[model samples]
Target: MVASSSPANIDKSIPSNEYLLEMNIKKVKNILIANRDDRFESLKMIDDIQGLGIDLHFQHEIDQTLDMIYKECSQFYRYYGRDPHEAALCFRLLRQEGHSVQESFFGNILDKEGKFEDNLQNDVKGLVELYEASELGVEGEETLDSVRKFTFNRLIELCSGRESHQEREIMTSLMQPRHKTSRRLTSKRFITMIKIAGQEDEWLQSLLRVAEIDSIMLKSLIQEEMTRTFKWWTELGLEKELLKARNQPLKWYTWSMEILQDPTLSEQRLDLTKTISLIYVIDDIFDVYGELEELAIFTQVIERWDLERLEKLPRYMKVCFEALKMITTEISMKVCKSHGWDPTDSLRKSWASLFKAFLVEAKWFTSGYLPDTEEYMKNGVVSSGVHLVMLHVYFLLGKELTRDKVKLIESNPMLVYY
Candidate 1:
């Protein structure tokens, strides 16, 4: 039923691009580079750059700048180190920049008894930084475990203090540190926080403007990438082939964004999203549609990993296999050209491993086998498709993988539980 158009329902056209201002990326890079010498200033700039969610664009610049600062001062261990706010900030940023940092730096703020000093509670910024820094701790790190527990309770108490209502940013950080949160949400949240609090430095103000403008453009770029992938999806025609499976290109793209959000990875993101979309169809077949015999053939086809094996797969699965093979080749060719490595072998291995895991579940489900807790848990981890996804992306990125590291990645104990 069509309703009569009213004034309130009047047409509003969406612009092709949201940005009206000139986006000078070079200018932002130059500004950050110009101040690489000032430790406090540079660290603050890095934090804002990250908080604003525009870090990916300036990563190389940030890395070089931090490298200079890291070697020049080891300032992570001195007078600035004595201040909890500065020390925590340095430690967090240093570790984030991929520089090796020791948690021992926190000793500067601790007392002879090895506790975060009582006086440190008065410093809101210090407590917030400590809380955030502590969140990055790995297992078995006693100091970080202790600090996380202490700062969490301490920061919760600060919410009652005057002007504390404005500390929503601190509250959010306590819940999930910047590194772990979605870039899209954190970018907007941090921009709001900084806008309200206001920075006094001219350079910071300029950089902040750049971050805002850049983030807007990046959003538009992602939108375009989504559109392009949708077009690719149409060409692939998964909806026609897999009538029972959910035809969800958009959702797959969103999931990929959560996995790898860098704007520069736009093309890579599209490829990955497309791969996941196909994975969704294939996964649904294994889960619900495919019979045991068909599932076995499909798993074997993946293991064989050849064009000739297409004849062995069932009708709908031929589409899935061909699509997977085509996409893998496309990704492989690009990676080879751009980074000089052949990802085909590794990708095939990952796909074969994933199919084996899927077949295990299919076998279990069909046989009505109720495995014991230990057996179920062991199979369930690999069956989760996480290892397959991680290994595929790792190979796609063209990072060097030593034999030992590859072994570690393939059967990492942490990933099973993680």
Candidate 2:
């Protein structure tokens, strides 16, 4: 593809349609050439085309533009195989031009491939600089910075090829003071806006969606950290206090209350609720939601072995024990009583399947045996306390959920992470 003529070569007086057609072709070509080096020039070309009043027809334009961009993007992936900077830029431009398709497209691409290499950190840094310069009016520079830090950390994971350490860093970062504060602020603003309007506004809905996605991601990271931490405990033969609140039940409850009462946490009530709900859901699955055989195995594992003595548990076996117990007992009791169940038979069976799955997972962990990926994934579906928690929340919140929704949640690959 031939690069477009420089900005100096455009004929200013042509009819808008013809000008747009010519500009489109030139822009595509220019972007392709500049794909290797010089992203700014390509962005400029796109901006010019956008200014031309070309209605490539909104949906058609979005589709064609993404196709062309990805075609060029594919070259970078084909050669270097994973340049997140280029990918991030590509998506940012698509969003700037009001093309949601490209944004979704790039998210899928990044989600599937993980992150770019560490040597290309400069590429990511440059992209951040460009994004800051653009001033898109997104809230919270610190939140964006957290995202950038996360992206870089993921890149490091990709480079090292062992994700445990990088995953730990991601968990720590998510719980960082600045990130949590920003999340709380954004959540409060959103809820307040909705309350005053008495309806869900588009912007608020979008913010909630973003928050949900972020929360889900953080939970996944936390799960990973739990696994790694468990491994460390087992390897070192150290009985460390794993849960944030350990001994005093009243103290734990008080601490939880304090966390909730904090202005930052209050602001992010929705997200915090979801996260806590997820923890409880996971706990219920392991303790009460699963089947008899599964529960038996889980009990056997936890009771038989000193967690600190095992060398390496299978990946699925690494859940936080206290978290599992606390969340399960709390949420299941609430859900059962609320639903008017007798709490013995009805409530007990409600969590039977989940418990069984957790037990199986614990057995695998204590045995230090890794199952096949497919088995791991299957077990994950049954074991995910968080998934059940979300389901309960959806039901309680009066949100619509179909079989399709359940499938989508089940299909998430991270479910395999236990």
Candidate 3:
């Protein structure tokens, strides 16, 4: 056993913070292991893990637990029958885990009139849970829509009468449901809730410790990412070169970070932020700087994706075009290596489509022609740059790529509208 000098048994040192992080993760996993049999408690712990932004560390365990829970409980809704909080919590968690839970799961909470029972109006905890669960509703779920309104209005009324921590928490949830809020932002609130409630359980304490450590580590990593991104931006010199273009790399980085909060997505976040920044820069060129003729030429250049046409472009257009080409190529190279397919042409076409849409808007603006709402929205969807951004995101993080999935993404599906 004393083979410390062996090549394979070299004594390597983990940084103290990293060591601490590993220990905390181990503690949290142990807590999950110990409480694996308690359905309600296990679900609550998973929710806490997610809310605390440490679910990335236990994704497999969380998935296994959810799958097991789904299997063990045949009559899922009836299992948590008569307890609104339990029922709503179960519904929300299962739905979040990609289970096709029915809206009628809350049937016990509904009155004969097919509306939520009046008694639930006064049950603050139940109402709050129901409000959060209702957020997972998709198109045409009348029951969830009604539940949201009922819970929202009751929670609003309840919070209006008090200035307590619980009231603040309720107001925060009412403002943005738990599912919609940023994990990092909500984790702070979750930590505050735990401390205020004086939860003295060992698992809660471990969860809290892990959350605190994670927050610190995440902050450091984000700072590093910001520094690196800023360095790249400065070296790109777009701000100095393209004076009229927006230079909001920090804001762009915020979008990337918030949208992709998992620490493991650092590279993807940077690529996304870079793509977004270019979108803004190119958008500004079209809307603010470029003459209609210049924008038209720029659109054609992008459509062709030929740098040989660079001689015909104006100085500013050339700068923007080169930067766009470079970024697109860099992303394509990375994606091709990982996904085993070149996305270069697809990426170019996406940008070309965006520019064409922008040119349409530019022409309309120049001629003082305001299209009808339908016409404007139809064009606006393309000009929105959502498809462009999402295209890049798909290629960057897409695990599996089928012809159908590629077609769906390229079609600019209804997902981008929302």
TM-score of 2: 0.31
Q: What is the TM-score of each candidate against the true structure?
A: 0.81, 0.31, 0.90
Where's the lowest-lDDT run of ten residues in candidate 2? 49-58
Q: How does candidate 1 fare on TM-score?
A: 0.81
Q: lDDT winner among the candidates?
A: 3
Better of 1 and 2 by TM-score: 1
Worst 10 residues of 1 by lDDT: 14-23
The digit string of per-residue lDDT tens for model 1 on 1-418 reads: 8977986765556322233223445666787888877777788888888887777778899898888777875755774666887878878888876787777777777789997788888787888888788877778878878888988888788787657555675677787787687767777777766776666856556666777767678777888988998899889887887788988888989988878877667777877787777667877989978889988888888888766666866788888888888999998898889777676777787778778878988898888988898887777676676666776677567677565666677556347566
Q: Per-residue lDDT of 115-135 in model 2, one digit per residue for the tens?
A: 533454544344443233223
lDDT of 3 at 398: 69
2 or 3: which has the higher TM-score? 3
lDDT values, one for every candidate? 0.76, 0.42, 0.85
What's the CA error at residue 329 for candidate 3, in Å? Answer: 1.2
Candidate 3, residue 188: how far the Cα is off, in Å: 1.2
Tell me how candidate 3 scores on lDDT: 0.85
> What lDDT score is found at residue 104 in candidate 3?
80
